[model samples]
Target chain A: MHDAVLRIAGLRTQFRTRQGTVDAVSDVSFDVRRGETVALVGESGSGKSVTALSVLQLLESTGSIADGSIVFDGRELVGLSEKEMRDVRGREISMIFQDPSTCLDPVFTIEDQLVEALTIHGTARSDARGRALELLRMVRMPDPETRLNAYPHELSGGQRQRAMIATALALDPQLIIADEPTTALDVTVQAQILDLIRTLQAETGAAVLFVTHDLGVVAEIADRVVVMYAGRVVEQGSVFQVLKDPRNPYTAALLASMPGAVAGTGQRLTPIEGVVPSLLDMPSGCRFAPRCPHAWDRCHEADPPLAAFDLNRESRCWLEVDGAVDGVGTAEVVG
Target chain B: MTTVAEQPDAGPTGGTVDGPVLEVEHLTKHFPIRTGLLQRTVGHVRAVDDVSFHIDRGETLALVGESGCGKTTTGRVVLRLIDPTSGTVRFDGQDLAEVDADELRGLRQRMQIIFQDPYSSLDPRMSTADIVGEGLAIHGMASGQAQLDRVTDLLEKVGLSARDLRKFPHQFSGGQRQRIGVARALATNPELIICDEAVSALDVSVQAQVLNLLKDLQTELGISYLFITHDLNVVRYIADRVAVMYLGQIVELAETEQLFTDPRHPYTRSLLSSVPIIDPELARATVRTPLEGDVPSPSSPPSGCRFHNRCPQAVERCRHYAPVLVDLNDGRQARECPEYRPEPFGLTAQSYRESELLNQGTEAGE
Candidate 1:
């Protein structure tokens, strides 16, 4: 039996905004297996970030988990009190936020902050400082001694991010939830950070829930990809299956729209025509129906369930139900 | 011709009838760091130093680099949005630096700029009609019904409706606002548009729409573009020629395909290797030539080659001898990194071809 670090099923997260109840995440189900990196990929308003926040029970007061269950390491996380959840957080599960500039406390030095993380989680007080140094070196922060004494503002963007990762690993949490960790950094620095994360994950064997919008980064680090669109899971599969031969039209459209070296020059990008539907005024049947090129009469009647075709492969689309996989293979041959 | 007298050298852009639409020579802009409350000059931050590139008529030349590499600053300097400490900006066979006030005002109509952030670039208080039509009115190209008609035409050209004229910036989505920005840049019927990370802020789907619109507009109007961005994928799609910047200098320049397939400069090679390939199989199979450490501060750039600090193939000569940009054969050029050799890094032709076939397979299904 595989060791699953986190298993979330039928999760529904809602925010009571002034306009109405915004269903940020609805009917999402996935799992993060131990020592595996699963990427939650989506664009803005896709609820990928909200799903991460919900997993950690770190949603704002205005938002709450309305349905489903988030089970972590054989323990239920839903309905846990803030104080009880706080104990579970950072001890068993840690989070690395998107913006490293704002994530760390501006007033505190790197050493003080990391020491606090170690000491708060029950490491003896005397050893916290030494542990902080070790953590800094682990992330390969150059001149760790000097960096430990400096504030977050003193470090560069890449350095600050490495410090953030070190802090996330301070407690040796079983799972790390990172939300667009390298989105703010330059491409060169982004590559380094991704490599660092991969190396550390291997050394520590911690399951990683990486949330990002960049499909390239997803391909680089993710073993499995969970594609979310407008608060719903559109596709879930191994990276190779989804990227090479996508079953869902939305996923295919996203892959097509991305400018790649293969497309080169003089290629008209296959853009999805419409904007993401608003949560308050969502479309009747499928939210992406208006934009999906293959959307048909069946698609306009009801939303498709996430159907499994192969092991660890599922796509939520009417075409998949109608046996379009063979048609795609034939189309490729004709080309 | 009159502008040439002030700069002395006259530069490449002056009195050349068949020259490129834009010619920039030895451009350098150093921001002085004032310190000690006396506001005395402490040191210089060499944001853009000795940078030079040109955009041909009806062509797009992309200036690409990481953040703080002076690509954006070069764009602003070419447009004269920021005054260069020393350089020559020649537009349409005339020097821009020595143009008189009246002549400069007239020259402004020929050059326009598009910013990266659509949210902040447009004034929230101004209606779309005023924003797009403001340039038309200022340049005195059209007025009254003609200006309104022109604004409507421009808006329609960019995929927005005439009904959107009355709406404010806040009312439009990010993509729509970017379209408005594009319309405003087109209001003056400019020969050259400086796009500084223009499509970087949009979503992938929206980015494609904007990119297609840009391509279509270029074909229709024959407008040249100084497309500045860090995204290589977009560069490969839109740019004809690309100049890669590092610290404050141009490290490499080449035709888009030439640069992508065979980058000679170590920095350019490292950058290309670092870009995460979309294909999971290809990405996993490739072994990247990792660049070491962060970019050095431009204010205190390393002696000789700025990239020497991070270059894996750096030799003893790279640390002392600052190499000049040298022209290679076949319309390709690179800064002389003497220690650098063309070693194939990341994603061989076989892997690239496989990924391309896979991508085509996805498209064939469509």
Candidate 2:
């Protein structure tokens, strides 16, 4: 396996609310290897976004990374000062958000934003414009020269996202953390963006820490998959291993819930019976036990660790521990 | 608003209605953009332009499109929430445009709409009972204890407990809140329910539960649905027929399976190919011809074919001659583009021809 571009171990991010402190991400561990796309897959409030935010140390004032080690490019980033982190942010590990409209300053033109991204990282102002134009053309932004002067609002959603990607790539960052970057886009536009990212990643050899709720997108783009539920890593494996033969009950149920997973039309989707438990009042045992059909007394009484069942395949399920066969048992559990 | 007693004798379900429950023809909605002190009309944003479709009894007809394609506008116009600039919406064989206010109100009881966001759609101030029972009281169907009873039944029907009647919208989860929305929509026993991206905001598990609930309700109540959404996967799961909209125009309309298997429109094919497949192998293997460029502004769409600019197979004729929907006589309709030729089975015409050439080469070698 290639060297990990970014490694996160025992990451526990917490938010201090008025009522109490809630652990948004608990013991979430994953790694993004060089030149590979690792998807942090989860539903809303699954703490996938928190994990991304924790890596960049960009958590809101109320939130903080309580514990964990985030090693980026063989350097510790957990206790880095804000000044030091800023130096690392745009130059080494760039981030892309769900909405490009909010990320791009409405007042500034695309050229100004891209040029600023370059200048902050020590590129000369005169040279930044040429680099910005090159980045725009690299991202396949339509009419790059014309779009460089266009304000964020003037550009279409796809164009704005392309500009955002260009800004992220302004310094040729080694790692890209994209949080649901294509969720807000139309399907066609999403496909285009996904294609662009894949192509650019191949060209630049930049590792992507892709976070998304859509499993279909994960399948489309990700080489590896890390499934999170209630701030815990429920499953982590190669895309085919996790998606085609998910060992964790939560992962299986999530797959079954998707309309595309089922055969034929109007078939009843095997839905997980309950909602994701509130972070404050999470289950004492397995967080997904309440919804898992295969959950037994052991599942409700003790939380299972993310145990490796095969090489490079891990699942947080008691069933996997008991040597349950792959594919067959998971299907029955979903049923 | 008059009481039910003072209202006319004609009710929505009073007569034996024939044909489809909802028939929309040439529905067009244009918002006039004003830019001067006098507020003079500068130009019209044609949100829904010459759109037409129908929903049969107990059938789901999904209006699928990208954002700004005007599927929601069509839904609103069909419900007469927004009056159409030019079109006829026939509900139960009565032209909605010609109907009086009182008549429209009476007809509205049989039509309900569920919005996408469960968070904002429900009144946070009102309890579940008030939210669900409001429609009942407004239509003069039930009141007081009787209204509570009906609301309770609706709650149970939509997979909620009777105890939830007194709870506020905030007390419920997103899926539960959506269930409340469904209950409120069903409170009036509406024949045609317009679900405008109803499950788009939900989690996958929650979405499945809600979709199953909706399907069960349709099976039981024979309720027709105008399911408007941008999610093609959901459309395939829920809709019997689909109308693919582009720049406020219905470019293609066909049965769900037929459309998926043998799409005749270039836009539909591109749209289908763009949807990320769940299977990893299939997702990677499928050749995707993703439509380039964002959808053009509805205010100033492309000259002839609205999709011409982004279309991969655009030709000279597509730029000058606007295509009209042509019936294929197989319960399907697609815009008549001369350049569009239906591919054989799953392969595109280009790839199929390449494979044929490869096979011929192999034969020659053999």
Candidate 3:
């Protein structure tokens, strides 16, 4: 296999709120190949965003990556100094944020921002504008000449996203992390933006680690899927294996709960049953145990480790530890 | 009769009564684009143009499209929140456009809207009780002890506790605030609701709860829903029939099952294909026929099919002649498109397409 561009091993991040520490992400890990798309999907508060931030060492002051390692280009990122990490960021590993409306600087022209990124990354003054224009075209933005002078606010929503992606790709980074990049875009524009991301990745051979709650977008471009729940990866596999035959109860419930997947439900959705446990008051066992329909005594007594789920997948469930294919067993019904 | 149980699970064919509770005929809303310091109208944005659909009592009719596709505009016009430039809106037996301001104010209780963003919709300064009870106070339905009772009842009905009444909107989560929004809408005891992306702002888990709540409320109260959303999943879950919109017009309208299983419109097919499935294998394998270009501005739409710019199967006819919304005789339809009739799959059906469409009508009903 080609060397993974960014590999996270046993990563964990926690937020220290007023009441207590919230395990926003625990024992989470994944990798991005040179030109592949890896989607991290989960409901809100599932720690998907925190994990992304942890990779970049961009977590808020109150948030901390409590454990594990982030290996970028075979370098250990966990112990890097803030200043050193900053140098690597945006040049070697960059991110495109969720809201296209606010991500760009309102005062800066698209040219100014892209050139600044280029200049900071050590491009010569004469080459900055040429490089910026090239990056814009790389993202498939139309009318590159006029668009370069436009401020983010003057550009349309899709234009702004294309600009954002251009800025991220300015450094020719190895991995580009996108957090709900299409959430603010309309469906048509969303289609356009996702296509732009895929096309750019194709031409540049850059790995994309995408974070989103909307599975619809995930299914469109993701080569691998990682399902998060309450700060832990409940299931991880190839998009086909996980989405077609979800091995975890949480994954199944989430699939069944979607209104579009099934024609119509004769019975109510087996919707995980309760709210996510507040991070301040993390549960003793599986954080999802309270709402999990298959939770048994083992689930509530001890936290399960991420183990062999399917041949290619891994799930943090004790019930599936023995590699059961039916996605159900006696231990699955315990608790 | 097309009953769900008695029949072979045909969608929306029914033992239940079907008649218009809400009828919109040729509705149009044009927002003028003002430019320069003079603020002169340079052009008009046809946010909703000659759109027509009828929501039968107790049924959920979804207006679905990409954002800015005019679904939200149509939802607002149906409630008369924004005055339509021209159209006839008949609610029950009354003509809504003809009603005076005073009479329209009285009718607000019969029609309500749940906004997309719960955070912005409710007043941050107001407590939950006041927000939900505001409708009751406006209609003079109740006050003081009665107002408190009404608000409290509304809270429980939306699956929220009465204790949450003292909390402000910012104090609540996105999903909780949406529940409060739903509670506020129900305070009027409205028979018809315009749900404008009500569940889009919520998490998947919380969305399920809210959808179930809407379903339970629908069955119990016999309320009709004009559900507006871009999320196909939620539409499939709640809608009885759906209208697929693009560039301020409905391209197709039909029962939900037929729309998903056998879509006639190319745009409709693309929309269904865009919906993400949970299984990764299917996600990878499913060939997505994604729309290629951005939706043109409403102020400057395309000459022919608005979707023609991005549609994968555009021919010369699609560029010159604007398709008109026409029925296919079968249960499903394309609101516009010359290829309105459904030909059979075989070579013989291709020879007599109109006859094939007529022949399919019985199969659709059965």
Candidate 4:
């Protein structure tokens, strides 16, 4: 638990479109350690997926990482070439996508996909088949023998998600990034998948970077949560701290927006007042300031940096932490 | 799709007590299927089976369930959007089930339906103004200057700007499209409007805004709503009386507050338990009774208690005799549980409380 497997410092991701360069992630930093599941959560386009892809250097060709120090096993990953990164990907650090049916090729059966993944990663055909069977069994796929021969389309949504998890765990990767893994499944099935992820994490002691918007899933699994709004980290803290006592306005709004929220009792939901501003053109002060109820006149002037917190909780906001000591100026906020 | 039944036994339409705006009695619709091309009625999908409920002059009656539970079919049948195979539908003391075709058409003007999907419900080629004013054209409500005036008024009532009247549905977002749907439903000045998952497509923020709009509209214009949705969270807040559906039948029907807090039906309890509360620690508080196995096809539903196969409380009676919607201990309460109100008298809440045994969830580790 104490071992820090991955540490990211001051990560910045940007997309240079025809209109202009838009900062998707700004000076964001967090760590995922052995046996711990850290959740990166926010609404759509809040840079949760971007942060995971940035660490993997798997961002779409048009998108690129502008600045950051990604240290895995005390080695820099930002400067690594495509060939070096390819070897590291799926072998050491793997990613399981949201929809496995899309990721799994229609032409190939479960047997073919699993065996091929093993062989490409340097394993003999017989050995790969043996290991693939084991992997299928590990994920608890019913009738593993018959399912190995069945195609992805033949399997249900839950079964396909399990197959994807099997593929991700095939190479014994140190870190696994799961992005909205259980969104497509039913509640009971979601519970099963979540339990599987937790069990796997415990057995392997592999670090996990989970990404989702469903607070319920996060509550069931996440140890710590990083809240993103627009293209920036608005709040970062322990699961208890972020969910129960969120200091950031955006985080609070998200918590309030959830259906059947007792906290939002008669208050006409002042839900993040406006639509998300286009990434091509952003506001000057805080990206969330326009929607934030707590935003003051001074907020419009400059971008707010991630202010240092006395505790582990860190927020990029103009809100005064500890009420007195202002280490940094009220700078320009991401537009 | 069927025609209204013939008269003589058209009961509720007698117009007693100045009539309920919409009252459905023993309503049932069964679709027959056959093998090969012989056209034999082998069996039926009893979509809405013996469903009976009434919407008061200005009260909203919410019908909620998971997919394929026949909730949408029930709502369509109520509006006469689809005719029921059997049972009686009385609207404003008029027996709709017995009413003739020309008479039903005239009554439809006073009863409108707002569909679930906004995109598919409206004509894509038509502009917003054309969409809203089409009803006026159809019923010959107004024309020329007066028609434009009514359409503009509806646009404002639904919170759309006057300029939006010129735009098509493609030009507006999902939330805006739903608002236009609401406006179209309102065009007829109908006393009863059925909103079939009206705000299901909208985002959380947008959903809240739409819900608030619906509440406001209800207050301003005393329109009764028959709201249908799969979202229990929304139902918990919006519904006055919720009827929990399973396998083409309402297993539980009670005041929203009572149903949510003290659910009698096992299906209702499990459905409520499955919802994810926002607060993490609180989310953990609800005793989870996870349902297993795929939902049985409505075509081949379990006999007796339709939910008995999946229900946690499947006793001997659940397999043998069908439970009737009878009065429970609570004066106004009615449930389809056999043990609820047993024979041999006026069983008060206290008497039944002593007799009925507590039930642990069906599965292990529930």
Which numbered prediction scores highest in lDDT against the true structure?
2
Spell out the clash pairs found in candidate 1: none
- CAPRI classification of candidate 4: acceptable
Better of 1 and 4 by lDDT: 1
Tens digit of per-residue lDDT, candidate 3, span A143-234: 78899999888777778888999999999999999999988887656776887788888888999999998766776779888999888888
Q: Model 1's lDDT to the true fold?
A: 0.85
Interface RMSD of each: 7.9, 7.3, 8.4, 7.0
Candidate 4 chain B weakest ten by summed lDDT: B1-10
Error of 4 at A84 (Å): 4.8
Error of 4 at A205 (Å): 3.8
**Which candidate has the top score in TM-score?**
2
- The weakest ten consecutive residues by lDDT in model 3 chain B span B357-366
Candidate 4: segments with Cα more than 4 A from true spot: A1-27, A53-100, A105-119, A122-156, A187-200, A263-272, A321-335, B1-18, B29-47, B80-88, B95-105, B113-125, B315-324, B331-366
Ranking by DockQ: 2, 3, 1, 4
Off by over 4 Å in 2: A263-266, A324-335, B1-12, B340-366
Docking class of 2: medium
| Local lDDT at A5 for model 3 | 88
Q: Evaluated with DockQ, which candidate comes out highest?
A: 2
lDDT tens digits, residue span A12-120, model 1: 9999999988889999999999999999999999999999999888889999999999999999999899998998888889999879865699999999999999988
Candidate 4 residue pairs that clash = A282-A335, A283-A335, A285-A333, A302-A331, A302-A332, A302-A333, A303-A331, A303-A332, A303-A333, A304-A333
In order, the Cα lDDT scores of the candidates are 0.85, 0.87, 0.79, 0.75
Candidate 1, residue A65: CA error in Å? 0.9
TM-scores, all candidates, are 0.92, 0.94, 0.86, 0.82
